[model samples]
Target: MDTRDLARIDLNLLLSLQVLLEEGSVSRAADRLNITQPAMSKTLLRLRDVFADPLFTRSGRGIQPTPRANELRGELQELLGGIDRLVKGEAFSPADYDGEITLALSEYIGVALLPPLIQRLHDLAPRLSIRTITRIENQLEQLAQGNLDFAIQIAQTTYPPAYRWQTLGSSPPAILVREGHPLTEGEVSWDRLASYPLIRLYISDLDHLEIARSSEAFIRARSPQQGSLETSHLLTALEVLRSTDYFLPGPAYLVRNEQATRGIAALPVPEGASYELQYRLVAHERTAHSALHNWLWEQILDTLRGLRVRTIHRG
Candidate 1:
């Protein structure tokens, strides 16, 4: 059929056409439906003329829907719901969401931050479906393309103008050592730390030059060692440290959990030798106001506040 024909037809006819395509045979369709066989046949003919495609045809004992009919099924289902919502003025509530949401986050944040928030969301909105994609490269592009609703990352000193950011929390990096490591025994001096092997956690394109520069300055002033064994993940670094006398420097939250610290201890770095890492929630400003986006943003902030309170009380 021509585009002009579709424009002249009533849209409600499309729903009847869709139902006829599903049932295939006119008699079975009429039986399953409340309509008569002749009425169903009339609707099928109308659909054939409207789309200018034989949407279905007779086979041996039963009829079969053609490729076009098969393809229209999914689109029709969504369109029908959209039409219903528009006609009735449907509203969305966080507590009653039955839609799916996608989140992009780094491995560290996904492991240390999202669990409790997701659990709480599950309790509140059991029908909501959430999918998490990790270690997303080019996070801003993903957000702009609607592939990701939100992201969590270490806030950098500079960012593109398209992104809106909110600080979640910040904490200083800490040195982690095995329970019986020599450094944890007594007064661990800077020179004494350098005497043992060091395991470092490597983030994507993260500037380890700063660490190298600081180590050189320390060696120049206090004669400390300046060598490291690098690993890609924090958990692997912790594992290496546990087996050998190696030391690892990473965010405290990752190791603060019971599994990582069962036989590990966080050591105090020498005065003036630490860096602060700040966590930030980022999204495309244009899409940040969507209900799902805002809900995720609030969930993150709430989880961070609870974590802060727990940390303070524990201390």
Candidate 2:
């Protein structure tokens, strides 16, 4: 039916149609719906008028469904089932869910968080699927549109009123280099680091113009390291480091585990460096009230706690 026809249809007619098709007898359907036989007959007549088809006909003392009525039965059953669930006001149970949850994660947070998060999901909700997106051009917009359930990243810019975020942890920058790189063995001085070309990982959602101005200032006052290969992907930067003497400075938690796995190591930042970064767990205001999202967010916080502890130990 067209939208206007659908708008004219009554919701009670759908329920009555479901009961009539299941029972196959007008009298019995009325009993099931706690209404009189005449009232149920009136509803069936209204259904036939709306559908422009005789939905049921005589079959001895019972009723026989017309082909059109049979055609609508399966679709009506599913629609009513959704309505039932919505009205039930039931608490979400992960074990019972068999749907996919989508979230956005930047490269570093994905590396640090996905392994443990996937493991936990497997243990608790094996059938539930998780789809993570890394190439997000607009995180908050995606979240508000229900395309993302959660996102973990550094909030360098102010968020709009529709977002709810929690700080994961904050740390100063650390330099990452290949295992046998010269900077790893010697005293890592700003001048020594500046002597080699650097791989710059571009994160932080702050305006790019502001980042450029700040970067220029840092280069002038601190070191004249040319950001030879700048990218949003940390793994790409790490791959560049494997064959060359280039190193990148970033938050420790994002690189610590990847460093050990890839034969890379961290060098202490110069003692006077003042740059600090903080990661946050972000969700849309719409999803912040969801029990399932809240549960997952709490697990993320717990994971970050362990990350911070291990980073201290590694230092």
Candidate 3:
């Protein structure tokens, strides 16, 4: 806390602490830092003195961080990272930057957005590698901890203060049936829809649908059971619809191009029905200032906007 305490702290020691806290083994930490075991032990002793806490203690084969150490671990990584960035003092150039960017997005967005996004990256940042993962639990926590560069999913509620979200577009749910289906030729009404078996594509990644809640309630009241065919896979729902009288009620634009030829055509929802979902791009507050990240974010928004325009024209 004092100048003398600050003078005793070394950046290298801080990094060593990060590795030690992560690895929980002095030898392993030393190997990671490419330092001798004795040197690592000495650095740990210095870190203990500087922090005035026994940072780690023996726990079976490996060491466990104390409560104080556990608390310091998070702050230490961020602190060391900022210091490292400050020391490098290099501008971010997307074309020349060669690092892997991890993104967390759902299978739905992966199908709709990945192709265009990856193509854009290839054109602009040839050296940049993208690794996409499915949206997992504790998504915001993962994003804030730098596990994900960006997440493409539906945000049903407000995110924590540390996360930033950008609305892409909202798509009202539509009834998808075969090209020559009765609903396609007639006035599609909730009464008519309830007369046939429904194919529901359940998006497990969503906590709950923003606009689909009423639709869900109405369906439950009508059927009081799961859809005749229920699945999380969009293709599966479409496939079932292609072969059966089952009608799919989900995102309006899910069926496109080649799949549209699979006897798939969208039917407008009945009057006063509010089944829709708003997709958005969520990122950590820390990434907002990075030029490369911001550019990528803008490209995503632009791609989604174009898709919305095309959908509107087609509608």
Q: Which candidate is the best by TM-score?
A: 2
The best-first sequence of candidates by TM-score reads: 2, 3, 1
Per-model C-alpha lDDT, please?
0.72, 0.77, 0.77
Q: How far is each candidate from the true structure, as Cα RMSD in Å? A: 10.6, 5.8, 14.3
Which regions of candidate 3 fall more than 4 Å away from where they truly are? Answer: 1-89, 218-227, 255-261, 306-315
Compose the digit string of candidate 1's lDDT tens values, residues 131-203: 8775556676788898877777666566689898898887676768888888887876677776776765544
Residue 240 accuracy (lDDT) in model 1: 77
TM-score of each candidate?
0.62, 0.66, 0.63
Per-residue alpha-carbon lDDT of candidate 2 for residues 62-164, written as tens digits (9 for 90 to 100): 9999999999989999999988988875678878878888877777778777887788788887888999877666777778898889877665457788788
Q: TM-score: which is higher, 1 or 2?
A: 2
TM-score of model 1 relative to the true fold?
0.62
Clashing pairs for predicted structure model 1, backbone only? none
| Cα error of candidate 3 at position 248, Å | 1.7
lDDT of 3 by residue, 1-315 (tens): 589867767878888889998899999999999989999889989989888999999878888998989999889988988888898756878899799888877665667777777888888889999998763766677788988888877765667788889888777777788878888877987677777787755553445435546556446634544357766666666777887777876677566645433678888877767656678788999998887788888877887777767777987
